[model samples]
Target: MRREITGFSNPTVKLLKSLRDKKHRKREGLFLAEGLRLLTDARACGRLPQMLVMATARDPHPLLDALEADVLASGGEVIVTSADILSKITGKDNPQGVAGVFAEFDTSLDRLDRSSAKIWLVAQALRDPGNLGTMLRTGDAVGAGGLILIDDCADPFSVEAVRASMGAVFTQGLAQAGWDDFLTWLRAGEGQLVAASLREAVPYRGAPYAAPCFVMVGNESRGLPEDYELACDLRVTMPMKGRADSLNAAVAAAVLAYEVLASLEG
Candidate 1:
């Protein structure tokens, strides 16, 4: 039987709304995934959402039917609620008509296979969720080992991030670590760190990318910190004969990721 929730004031609905806050999400060890595609991707990635919520009026969204059936088979609960309640729960003007709460996967760099040509895209102080999500999607596309988010990076599970990733967030492994933690991992793997910079004389194409490595992209506005200049094993720049100063952080990451992939395949 599908449970019906009428009011946003209901305790269950209230708890769902709390998930919008980072602290609450952390405390509960879960995050919200909105829309049909994200929910589908989550399941495909072996992430079973604990609860599925859908607006009662929007029942037959074709993509959602399979998801609902799959959730039911997986011993998950499906709730039907009004649009008003969904909006309040999601804090979105137009709720995607579907949303779900999924258990957060504990992703650690230690889980990765070090014997492979492990590649990670580390975002340092990247404040924009969209940029972070784009990087995640690109990372997954290029078969990156995982993403390592450094200090002060945006929450990869946020609504903006999920939307920007277009469902790649759930498919990719992610590790959020501070500078020291990343440094520790780098040392453990003996992986080379290549920092992207506009001032570099060495083009990324010429770098020794065949080895196990992690590429670092800095903040959207300010580039990498002064200390990162010394930390990186190699500093690389993209060739641009045109007038553009630099590529966007996400674009730069995609270029570097594909370059690494090409090197591995060749």
Candidate 2:
């Protein structure tokens, strides 16, 4: 069944808009993702949003039609509202015509199947939603099975990160865990923990990267702690010849991911 939400004062509107904040999302156990492409990607990934919000004048499309149909067929609800309301919900001046509310996934370390792919991306204290999303995008690009966030990372389901991921959030498996828990989990499996480092590290290129190699990056500002680096099976460094001393956390992951990809694929 479908519904229409026309008033800004509507409690549904308020709840939908509240999803823009982490607290509301945590309370509701739902996160919002805007844009038709992201919704379509979610659908393709065998996920259907529990609630779909669409603008009243949205242009017709087969994909959107398919999405709406699937949502209804699966006993989900659709709300048709004005573009301005969509803007309010998304906190965007020019909101995408559609948004979806999906339940957060199981993000425990045990839910991750490490042996499924050759490379995995891990971030420690990554604070930026955009960077987190970019890491997910990089994971998708490198054909990694998933992204494992270790300690105090950005919320993977935040709208900004979801938007930045460009649908990689839906495609990539995501797990969040404390550093010690993650290390314990990794040790229990046949996985290699690798990170970018400067303390007696090898060049990132052509390293002895193996299947299930975890390419780890540290906090955007603080870098990795000494103990964290020491725990890694390998520590490789990227060259910084120019004035820039280091790469962005997400960029570093992408570069290291690609190198690891080449090494394992070769």
Candidate 3:
């Protein structure tokens, strides 16, 4: 049975609206997952939100039956709300019929299971949400074990990032750590740290990509700091004949990640 929320004063609605901000999300340990597709992905990953808010103005989506039933079975709340209310929560006009407020998953380098992980991706100071999200999607496509986000990166849980991820956000293992901490963690591990750099003499194809690989990608502008690049086990460069000095951060990451995947298979 679904609870009908007809007014703006509902506590659930307020909480969902507040989650649009990063600080609020971090404080509450919650984030919003909009659309049926993302909810479907969450359900597939066994990470479905405890609270669901559906637009009552639209016809029922047959796809939502199983999810709604599960939520109700778990003693979770399903809100039957107006289009205006859904739009207010999602900050979009005539938003999708389904939206959910899910608790964020905790991830850390220390918590990562290295035993089964073949390769991981580290993005240092990557500020673009679209790039980060796209990279995550790419990482998922190539079967990366996980992703490490360095200091001051875009909030991966942000609406733009989550939307851009197209459901990869739910499937991928993600963690955040500062530069020093990440470096320490990288060095402590047995995996080969392959840093993507513009200064490296070795071409990307020639890099020593071994099992348990960790591919490090830099920021949109500055890239990996020189000392950081020098600290890596292997440094590789992608060659470009055109005037462009470097590739997009996400594109560079994808290229390197795929190569690492190929190396393991080879």
Candidate 4:
């Protein structure tokens, strides 16, 4: 059934407002997706939000029609509200015309397909949401099996991260582990551990990225811990002729990931 929410006190509106916070989102086991493109991408990835909220005065009406149809067909509720309500939900004065509340996908480590996982990414203590989001997109582009977040990393489901991913969040499998637990898993896994480092590392092109490789990257400010770097089977570095000490973490990961993929194709 289509419902029209006219007041802020409505239960659904309150719930949507609470979801803007990370703690509330975690407690509810749901995340909010905003914008038409993101919702379309969510549907493409086989996710139907439990509830969809739309601003009543969207200029391009056909997109809203399609979105409403898809949501209703999947047994989801569609709520139409004023522009003010949409702005309140998304914290933007000029908000997108649509938003959705989706249950979090299972990103547990054990859920990954070990056999077919040609390359896996491990991001350690990633603090930046935008970087992590781009990494998710890059990982998907390079056909990585999944991404594992070790230690204190940004929430992939956060609004900033999700927006930065450009919908890649729905397509990429994700996992979380601590440094020690990740080390244990890495030791038991059957792939070459390739890490990026400046000290005692070979050129990126020279490193052998064996099949079922696991690429490890460190935090934005701090590179991998020496012990972690030592654990890797190989370490590689990108060429830096400019004055910059290091490249953006996402760019560096993409370059290495594509290189690894290209090697396999060759």
What lDDT tens digits, residue by residue, belong to model 4 across residues 100-167?
98998786666777567688788989899899989888888898887888898989888888878888
User: In the order shown, what is each candidate's alpha-carbon RMSD?
Assistant: 2.4, 0.7, 1.7, 1.9
Clashes of 4: 0
- TM for every model, in the order presented, reads 0.89, 0.99, 0.93, 0.92
List runs of model 3 lying over 4 Å from the truth. none
Candidate topping lDDT? 2
Tens-digit per-residue lDDT, 1-266, candidate 2:
89998999999999998998999999999999999999999999999999999999999999999999999999999999999999999999998899999998989889888878999999999999999999999899999999999999999989989989999999999999999999999999899999999988999987888888999999999999999999999999999999977899999999999999999988
Q: Which residue ranges in model 4 land beyond 4 Å of their true spot?
A: 60-66
State the number of backbone clashes in model 3: 0
For model 2, how many clashes? 0
lDDT of 3 by residue, 1-266 (tens): 57999999898789899999999999999888889988999899888778988988767666788889888888888999989999999998859888887888886778776556778888989999899889888878988877889888999998778877888889888989998998788677678888777665588885678878888888898988898788888888887899987889889889998888887887
Sort the predicted structures by TM-score, highest score first: 2, 3, 4, 1
Report how far residue 152 has shifted in candidate 2, in Å: 0.8
Window of ten residues with lowest summed lDDT in model 4: 108-117
lDDT of each: 0.82, 0.93, 0.85, 0.85
